[model samples]
Target: MERIILHCDLNSFYASVELLSHPDLRQTPVAVCGDPTSRHGIILAKNEPAKRFGVQTAETIWQAKKKCPDLVLLPPHHHLYREYSRKVNDIYGQYTDLVEPFGIDESWLDVTGTLHLFGGDARALADTLRRRMRQELGLTLSVGVSFNKVFAKLGSDYKKPDATTVISPENWREIVWPLPVGDLLYVGGAARKLLGQYGVDTIGQLAACKPDMLEQLMGKMGLQLHSYANGLDADPVRSRFEKEPVKSVGNGTTFPQNLTTRDQVRQGIAMLADSVASRLRHLGLYAGGLQVTVRDPQFRDRSRQTRLSAPTHLIREVTETAMDLTEQIWKPPSPIRALTVTAIHLMEAEDTYEQVDLFGGSAATRQRSEKLEAAMDRIRGKYGSSAIAYGAAAPEKEEDPLP
Candidate 1:
């Protein structure tokens, strides 16, 4: 039997939530943006009115204002967003236990088992969900109903605020094949450009391509897109309760000023690595490898990764490794707009066994570092994150605070 999947996407999530409190801005052009003084002034989201004026998400505030001078900018309140997300997901749980959250504002529901209880109509159920969200939370969502997760997500994107689109086996080809190939899941900029080179601009073109040829072009991702375009996605919607293991922990930040010196770059890496290491320790995991990505002033990113001699969750070790990796891709006096430090090749603390280096005292040093950082974690847990931090990693002022 074909599985029934429904992808629910909250429309213009950040701006929509912000507008709830500013009801007077309902028909006005509105956007949610970060602080411009901090150089984090990007449009996080925009309402339909702002969209009509060509305001786009992630564009600089000045650029958006050029298009929509009347745009009302609002700051984000993440706590309220989280509260509403939980409430919305709870409502979904009332219909099916197989609820899988795709992001903070989107989810996938496998309703095949409980469709009969909800009148055996996926379209009706999707509309009901939209209605419930608006009535209960003063928010709206667009829902996509299909036989698979990928198509279901595509369906949700096919419409706008408070809408439902159904893609069935009988009509999927007609409804989906005509759309741009980039509309399919995971078809990012590089993939789209690659496909365009061969005149594969639409979903039908992608599906018509030989799978082996696609794999040759895009490796596994090319083949995956082919499957999605052909409606061959068989991936299951994992239940919310079924927690997936953590594969990696990473932290990144865009500084208010571009880093032009090695000292500034080191400080940035240390700050990010500290956060990554803390998260790894909190999860009772150790990183066997570390990756560093440096974004230049032009937004071009260069990344490098390295395997650690021994797995560790220590801040000092992670920071040192990240610095080394960053050095491989970046040099001093080159302006760095952002930096990311990722702890990869994770292993459970219990599963990780380290061998003593008989020729060196690195094992003893690691044990000491672990104890010191663990104490710092406890101090921060009780007094807050700002309570204790490495002097070298302290920011002059908080920049690009993460969500």
Candidate 2:
């Protein structure tokens, strides 16, 4: 049976959410992004009016202002966004327990068997949900209904304000084929360039290409591309509440110029390690393994990893492992481009108790470290992560923190 999936996405979420409090900002151009002074500070969100002015996410705030001088730039209120997200999720759950969060502003819902309860028509259900949300939360949401997550996601895009769209097998080809190849999920830069060779420039062209040609050109990703192009997405609407994470923790940066110093590379590793460590703490877990991914000046990417005898949450330990692995992993002297640290083999924070029996590590020491990590997180949560920096991180802040 063709399943029914609903993808709900808020319009220019952070900006729209802010507009709720300041009703005057409605119909105005607004963007949200990083600090104007920081290189990493780039536009993160641009509302519909601002988009007309050519403002886009990841553009500098200065550049965004150039595009729309009156553009309102709001700093991220992640906590506030999260609170609103929960409310939205709660609303979705009222319809189906299979709802999955795509992020702060988007989610997917499975309405396979429950449809009849609400009369089973995708269009009507979408309208009812839209009205209810507006009445209760004073927010606008666009919904896309399709057989799978990918097409439903695409259905949600290219929508009018406060609208819902349904894409199904019958009109899938005629409607979706003429759209750009990039319109299909996962067709980014390299994929586009490669597909252009087979005269596959649009969803129609790509769909017509031989499956073997796609597989030969793009490997596993080609299959996904083909399935989505045909409006045949069998992938389940996975519950976002699942504990298993797709990836543990990792970081990356683009540098202006290459670095000639070994110390510079080490400093980058330390900073990235700190980032990974912070994430580890957030999950109430520790890494029993580490991986360091490096990018050279020429854009070549490589990675190395180490398995630890026991998991540790100390930022210094992860940093040291990352630096050590980087030495064994990459040849030095050529200018370095980017560094990333990832932690894996994560076990719950409470899992430390079993370690004393297995490895003969001191239970008291383990308890103390866990307490210390929690306290540090608490302090950092209120005062910022840099308010109390680790010794290794002290030298790092002097350089660009974003990099």
Candidate 3:
């Protein structure tokens, strides 16, 4: 039997959630944006009206305002969004156990087995889910019903606001082939450009191309795209309980002022590495490698990666390695707008074994450091994140303290 997959995508999620509180602005062009004063002045999400005004997400606040002079800007309420996402997924749980969340705003559900209980009609069930979301959560979503995850996601994007689009075996080729090749799953900018060079601009064109040719051009991703374009995707929707292991853990921040000295850069890297290490410990994972990215004033980014001598979740090791990686790509006295530290090549803590050198006594030092960090974690959990921090990782205090 063919799988019955549904991809549900919340429409203008952040903006819609914000409008729930400000019902008066529902008709106005509104956008949820990051704080401009903190240098995060970008459009995170925009409502339908804002879309009509040519405002787009990830564009600067000023650029959005320039397109729509009367665009209403609201600060993001991340906690509230998370709460709603949980509630929305709870509703999905009522329908099927095979619910795989793509992100906070999107999820894929496999209703192949349970469709009979919900009237055995995929399109009807999709419509019902959409209606329930709108009535219960005061939010709208678009659902795509198809035989595979990729096509179902594309189906959801075919329509907008609160609508259901079904692409079945009988009509999938007719419905999907006419769309842009980029509309297919995993066909990113680089792949799209490569396909364009070969005159494969439409889904039909991509499907018509030989898989071997695509593999020759794009390696493995080429073959994957070919399968997706031909509606041969067999990927299953995993249940929420089947958590996928994280590939990497990272954190980044844009500094209020450009960091121009070695001390300032070290401080920034330490702060970011502290967060990365803390998260690694929480997940009971350790990093086998680390990567650091530095962005200058021109928005140009330089990145470097290095393999650790041994897997570790220690803050000192992560910070030191990240600083070394940053120094390789960056020089002191050069202004740095932002910094990111990523813990890569992760392994479960239990699966990792520490290697000790005969002369260094490093194993004993690491054991002590682990205990201290664990104690710190307990203290912060009992009190608050601000209750305790590593001395070197803590943010610098202002010269004139605020009252």
Model 1 Cα shift for residue 192 (angstroms): 2.7
lDDT of each: 0.89, 0.78, 0.90
Clashes of each: 0, 0, 0
Candidate 2 lDDT by residue in tens digits, 1-403: 7799999998788877777777887789888786644444678887788989999886667788887889987787778889989999998888888888887899999999788899979879888888987889888889988888888888888585689988887776777889889878888877898888778899988888788878988887898799788876787776667754535677776555565566667767777777788788887787878888787744477778877777876676787788888888666566676777888767775664344322354767667756876787889999997877655655543333232
Instruction: Write candidate 3's Cα lDDT for 273-336 as tens digits.
Output: 8899999999999999999999887668888998876898888888888988898988767789
lDDT of 2 at 276: 80
TM-score of 3: 0.83
Lowest-sum lDDT 10-residue window in model 2: 394-403
**Model 3 Cα shift for residue 390 (angstroms):** 4.0
* Per-model root-mean-square deviation over C-alphas: 4.5, 6.7, 4.6
Off by over 4 Å in 1: 210-219, 297-302, 305-310, 350-368, 375-403
Q: Pick the candidate with the highest TM-score.
A: 1
Quote the lDDT for 122 in model 1.
94
TM-score of each: 0.87, 0.73, 0.83
Residue-level lDDT for 218 in candidate 2: 87
Write out the backbone clash pairs for model 3.
Answer: none
Report the poorest 10 consecutive residues by lDDT, candidate 1: 394-403
